[model samples]
Target: MSQSPIVLTGDRPTGPLHLGHYVGSLRQRVTLQEQYRQFVMIADAQALTDNMGDLSKVRRNVIEVALDYLAVGLDPAKSTLFIQSQLTELAELSFYLLNLVTVARLERNPTVKEEIRLRGMERDIPAGFLTYPVSQTADITAFKAALVPVGADQAPMIEQCNELVRRFNNCVGKEILVEAQALIPDHGRLVGADGGAKMSKSLGNALALSADSAAIAAFVRSMYTDPNHLRVSDPGQVEGNVVFTYLDVFDPDKAAVEELKDHYRRGGLGDTVLKRRLTEHLEALITPIRERRAQFAQDPAEVMNILRQGTERAREAAAATMSEVKAALGLSYWN
Candidate 1:
């Protein structure tokens, strides 16, 4: 049987991906590549919406993010991996989607509001940052992507995209755009090593995908556990402990993880032992990815070539969609 139509998902190249990205979406992306038509976008333009002044950082990190994808085993043969700014359709589609979505609607979006607060930009929010949801509609619909994988916190973004899709199709009298479904993971969020609410580079809590073994080991070693479990004999709280949480996600030995949790909760299981085990588990998980990343790093030209080929394919698809979109809106007559 033929496979379902394409699914689009991606990340801004603000930083290397972390464990939160892995558990929250990237791991799923690697697996979904086999089942669906996947287009993995490196959203450099989207990153610039927030980092407008830091063009050099955004430019540099695109390569970093692409390398991370390769290190994680995202096969270019199976997944169309490309940079976002390379396609002109996104700009055109963004214009159309903006007209469909109101400024009030963008303001009401929960994710955008939260981000404004988080970035401390109550009054000075960049226009591009405010309009990214519209741009994202462009990214998704530019390829007519049917599925958009995201975390719960990002569901509103997908809702905004679909809302624009429906409005555009209805207004133009054609189903030219596809409505994308949000695929949220079972793990709602992944906490950082410092026990922050989320794993992030800005917070100094991320264990980067490209981190060397010593760096990974240090981060894992310094990871937060149950603060109340100060003594080995003290009963520990496993519910929110970072170590146990990591164990829950990465430990293939579920029975052993359960045993460790029980022992820790009952007292006598020290944080040191649990932390060591978590470190070992993380090492096993990260070592191969790091090794693969090193090999890819040795051939930067080859990596760029993969990205270039993917960009060409993505541009073709985006161009076709833009032609239909323009024709639907009577812009084709202008040419």
Candidate 2:
């Protein structure tokens, strides 16, 4: 029987996952695990590109991310959950791959450029931060993953990965490294609770998947709705309203959401009423996830064990690929 294609995707262990994660990629990962050979990584090393000062935070969030994954239905039996820092071969491969790409090209990567701008690091970009695409190429290529599920915004990173794949193959006069395709989800980006273009942990505008009832309620109450929607009788615009966006993504009843949108647009739907509805849906969606996360968190040892076993499996794959990479570069001299 032919093996299923490998799908590599992951999150940075900078913080617990939030509602934005659920809508954007976490929901898709649960579905992808059944159909593909999925490798979910907790990218601690990558998280350190900007979070180097907080080593403890990175270490703590590794288990936190793993717990979130388990709570969200990414089965250890079906999907391998590994830690990126554990796979030393990945860094080795990244080092070698870095040689194939020019610094100029790395600087030009749109994703990297945008990240630099967001972090306000234009004047002093870390070497690791600038070369993230190379590290990502190593992550994808080391596993021979042909499909990488990511946000639409990450298209440029995938393009750079394929470019490195072609360059490495051409240098070796053979196609040893396989090119990857980005699997962008149907759902667009999830806006922050404050209606920012992006929802981030550092921004303090995100609702964690493990949030309690009161926290969820508070977040919903704080959601950005139409500023012009001051009075119940006033018509409201739904163009950038965060509450409507959440309803569109989380509410299972599409017809009901549409009706709510119509009611909201035509006026007479109080912001409190809309917020209460959103709070109910969000609570329903998150309650089970929160419960499951609590159960997993109680046994942190088991979670670590799961990561260790998955890392072993990942290391084997990475090592095999590294051997081939070494041979391709004529660096396997002892052999």
Clashes of each: 0, 0
TM-score of each: 0.95, 0.95
Please give the TM-score that candidate 2 achieves against the real structure: 0.95
Inter-residue clash pairs, candidate 2: none
lDDT for each residue of candidate 2 in 120-170, tens digit (9 for 90 to 100) = 998599899998899999999999999999888899999999999999999
Give the poorly placed runs of model 2, Cα more than 4 Å off.
333-335
CA lDDT of every candidate: 0.88, 0.92
Question: Which TM-score value belongs to model 1?
Answer: 0.95
After the best TM-score superposition of candidate 1, give how far the Cα of residue 215 lies from its true spot, in angstroms.
2.1
